[model samples]
Each structure stands twice: as structure tokens, then as C-alpha cells.
Target: MSTQGLERQTRNYLSNNVPQIQQHGGNFEIREVDEEAGQVTVAIGGACSGCGIAPMTMKAIEHRLPESVDGVSEVKVVRAGGPRAAVMPSKIDEMDEMEEYEDYDPPF
Candidate 1:
């Protein structure tokens, strides 16, 4: 798949899933996407930054965005930090955390 195709897919996926994201007062903007490499980077803006639901928004995007689109092995979110890098967490590290919690016995 070409980069353009991947970007298009990512856009479509966002549009289709925007409602869900918006319901939580969050939004995402595509920065760049590479199809062959299956990499996508997006920016989260608006109320998402200060929202306590930010984690949910991030988790939802990380889990659903790639599955919703083709040729996307992973998704990266970037918070608007001007010239500096985005404030989003590393995808690999986030995935590792998710995996760690996937199977567990809560000591409640």
C-alpha cells in the first residue's frame, strides 16, 4: 500500500470513529502516515489535553484506529507542543503496559 493510500485509510478511519472520540470531548488530526511501514502519527487537540478521559481517548485510538484501517500496524498520537515533540506516550511502551494488564488477577 502506498503512503497516500494509508493516509486516506487513516483519515477515513478517523471520520468513521470521530463520533466516538468526540463523545468524550476529544479529537485527532493526522500528521503523517506511512503505509508500507504501517506507521501513523496523529495529533490530539482541543479538550483532549486537559480531559481526564485522555487515557480513554488514547487507548481507544491505539486499539481501534489501526484495526479500523488497513496497512496500519500502529498509531502514534502527538499533542500540539509547538516546535517541541508531541506529548503523547511511546506506542511501544504503551502497548507493553496494555499487554502487561491484559492478563491479571486483581487483589481487590
Candidate 2:
């Protein structure tokens, strides 16, 4: 298959697999797909951010992505809430302002 084809397939694979990842505790975003280098940069957010199992999650991606989608040789996960995760935030995180909700002190 062509590079473009591989990129498209990989993109779809990432999108489709997001739901499954979310079930694990967090979400994933495809930051970039390099067909030639056979690598994908994904931003992991929510509970998965600082979770210790995050590496296992990444390992699963690194192993399965290439097998499921051609041209994907590696999966790079960028944490979105961990110490390192602070460097990269998913689009959702970027759009959300947690501070706005902090003002709501509901007294039941």
C-alpha cells in the first residue's frame, strides 16, 4: 500500500481504538502519524495520565498497531496529566477550563 494509504488506515485505527482505550480509564489522541518512519505520536489524557499502567497501555499500542495497521511500526504515547504529560494536552483539555468549574461550590 502507498504511504498515504497507510497513513489513512493508521489514522482510522487510532480513531477506532480510542473508545476501547477510554474504557481503560483515559482517552487518546493521534498527535502525528509518520508513515516513512512508521511511528505514531499519541497524547494520553484523563486517568491514564499519571497511572502506572500507562506504560502497559503504550506497550499494547506498540504491539497491536503495527499488526492491525500496516506502516505502523511504533506507538509513542504522550501523557496529558502526568509530570511529563503537562507538556502536551489533548484538544479537549485545551478547550476545557477547569478553573471555571472550580467556582461552583454546591452545598447540598
Candidate 3:
């Protein structure tokens, strides 16, 4: 498939698959899609950035994304801003400040 075709496909895949990922509390963004080399780099973000299970989130994206794009050889992640990840949260420890709980009775 053409590179443009691949990019479109990749974008679509991300849009579609992201909700499934979010349901599990993982969030990510696509940083680069290299159709020539058949590689995709994703940046982990949101709660995923500080979660202890970040690797699991990365692996989940790596495993599923490639299969969606045509001619994808592999998924190359740059993490959230580390040597690998890009644009990582500046203060991972401060994430607790984001939590706000609302009690609700189940409709079911």
C-alpha cells in the first residue's frame, strides 16, 4: 500500500481502537507513521504515562497497531518523553491531583 494510504489507515485504526484502549485506562497518541520503513511510533500519554503498567500499555499498542496498517513491519515506540517516549508528563507524581471522585448509584 502507498504511504499515504498507510497513514490514513493508521489514523483510522487509532481513532477506532483508542476507545477500546481508554476503557482499560490506557491512552496514547500516534507520533509518526513511517510507511516507507513500515514503522509507527506512538507516545504514551494521560494516566498511562505514570501507571506502573506502562509497558503493558505499550505492548498492547505495539501488538495491535501493526496488524491494522498495511505493510507494517513493526511498531516503534518513543515512549512518553524519555529516551524512547516523547512529550511525557513533566510531573508524573503530581497525577494524584487530577483525581476527583463522584459517587453514583448504578443504573442497573
Candidate 4:
């Protein structure tokens, strides 16, 4: 099949079979599709950036894409920005300040 056809098939397979991706506010982008090598590169983006389950998601894609998409012998899934460190209030004063905003309505 042509490179474009393979890419479309891969995308369709993901869209239809992978519900978790979209359910978690995440999306995958086909970064590269090498027809001769039968390799595909996919990047997970959006809320998946710092998601704990991202590694499992990638593994699932790597394992399943090739089985479902014709001409795809290998799959590589990566995060768009990698995982991010979560930030939180570390002190009581900061926590109080945060609580203050809980009831403050925005002007907008």
C-alpha cells in the first residue's frame, strides 16, 4: 500500500480501537511513517504530557499498531513534552492563599 494509505489505516485503527487516548484528553500524532522500513512514529500529546499511565499507553500502541495496520512492522510511541513535575503548595501559608481563591469568583 502507499505511504498515505498506510498512515490513514494506522490513524483509523487508533481512532477506532484506542478509546482511552481520547477519553483522557489525549491525542496521537503520526510523526513519521517510513514505508520502506515499515516503521511508524507516534507522539502522545495534550493531557498525556504528564500522565502516569503514558508508558503503558505507549506500550499498548507499540504492541497493537503493527498487528492492526498493514505494512507497519514497528511502532514507536513518544510523549510530546515528556512528563512534568506536579506543583503544589508546600507551606501552610501557601495553602491558605490557595483556599482564599476557592470562593473568589472571576470577573470574566
Candidate 5:
């Protein structure tokens, strides 16, 4: 697929899944998509910023993204709170440096 097509597919996938993510008190922002590299960079924040299950969420994303969007090989995530590390295709980072979720209850 072309770079723009790949990017659009990824962004649309993310947008379509936003409600699911938000229901878990999380939000993902698509930072970029490197088509040549077949990678998607996502910023996850809100309640998911420092949650214990962030890695699980990332794992779910890692598994689902490729199925939802063609040509997507990996999903890289960044948290808003702190210790922002990229969650590569095979590994998830243990980022403990972040604010508690209570601080961002209402993100209006």
C-alpha cells in the first residue's frame, strides 16, 4: 500500500477503536505511521497513562492492529505521565513513572 493509504488506514482504525479505548478510560493519539517501516506510533494517556494493565492494553493493540489494518506490523505506544517508553512489536515497557489516574478523571 502507499504511505498515505497506510496512514489513513491506521488512523481510521485508531479512530474506530477510540470508543473502546475510552471506555477503559484510555485514549490513543496517533503520532505517526511509518509505512516503509510498517509501524504505528500511538500516544496513550488519560487513565491508561500509568495503569498496571497498560502492557496488557498494548498487547491487545499489538494483536488487533495488524488484523484491523492491512500492512500494519507493529504498534508503538507512549504514555503521557512519565517515563515514556516505546512498546515495540514484541515487547512492552514497564513505565512506572507517571501520575495517578485520579488526577485525570474528567478530561473535558
Candidate 6:
């Protein structure tokens, strides 16, 4: 299949099979489609930016896209804004700590 055709099929597959993406204010873009190599790169954006579950979503895409899209043997999913855009567990822990200290004031 041609690259454009594969890309369209991928979009349709994601839209129909992954409703959660849109429901959570997230959208995906086809970054690259190498028809010759049978590789497709997708970027997930919007509210999925700092989401903790994005890895799982990416994994699902990696696993499922191939099954649904003919000639797409590999799917590489990347976070739209990259690693800094992800909310790490340490950040959540820090936020929790800040909440605990909300009532305390340091005398300087």
C-alpha cells in the first residue's frame, strides 16, 4: 500500500478503536510513514502530554496498529512534547510534600 493510504488507515483505526484518546482531550499525528520499511511514527498530544498512563497508551498503539493496519509492521509512538512533558512520579511526590507543608511558614 502507498504511504498516504497507510496513514489514512492508521488514522481511521485509531479514531475508531481508541476513543479514549479523544475522550481525554488527546489527539495523534502521523509523524512519519515509511511504507518501504513498514514503519509508522505517531505522536500523541494535548492532555496526553503529562499523563501518567501515556506509556500504556503508546504500548497499546505499538501492539495494535500493526494488527489493524496492513503493511504497517512497526509503530513508534512518541509523546508530542517529549520527555520533559511527562509527569514523573517524583513530581507527584513533591506535590504531595508541598501539600503537607502548605500550612507551615518558615521564619527567615
In terms of lDDT, the best-performing candidate is: 6
What is the clash count of model 1? 0
For residues 21-50, write the lDDT of model 4, one tens digit per residue: 788788888999999999999987776655
lDDT value for model 3: 0.60
- How well does model 6 score by local distance difference test? 0.75
Against the hidden true structure, what lDDT does model 4 obtain? 0.72
lDDT of 3 by residue, 59-101 (tens): 5656777776677779865346554332245554343333331
Over the stretch 15-86, how does candidate 2's per-residue lDDT look in tens digits? 676454567566776777777788878777776664545555565666677889867788776666555342
Locate the minimum summed-lDDT window of 10 residues in model 1: 99-108
lDDT (Cα, 0-100) at 27 in candidate 3: 59
Lowest-sum lDDT 10-residue window in model 3: 99-108
Give one digit per residue, the lDDT tens place, for model 1 in 14-66: 76666655565556788887766798998776555544444555656777777
lDDT of every model, 2 decimals: 0.64, 0.62, 0.60, 0.72, 0.66, 0.75
Among these predictions, the greatest TM-score belongs to 6
Model 6 agreement with the true structure over 1-108: per-residue lDDT tens digits: 788999999889889888788798887889999999999999887777666556567767888889988999999998676543445555534543443434432210
Runs of candidate 3 with Cα error greater than 4 angstroms are: 20-27, 82-108
- Alpha-carbon runs more than 4 Å astray in model 1: 20-26, 82-108
Residue runs of model 5 more than 4 Å from their true location after superposition = 82-108
Q: Candidates sorted by TM-score, descending order?
A: 6, 4, 1, 5, 3, 2
Candidates 4 and 5 compared by TM-score, better number: 4
lDDT of 6 at 35: 92
Query: How far off is residue 7 in model 4, in Å?
Result: 0.5
Q: Give lDDT for model 1.
A: 0.64
RMSD of each: 6.9, 12.1, 9.1, 12.5, 8.7, 11.9
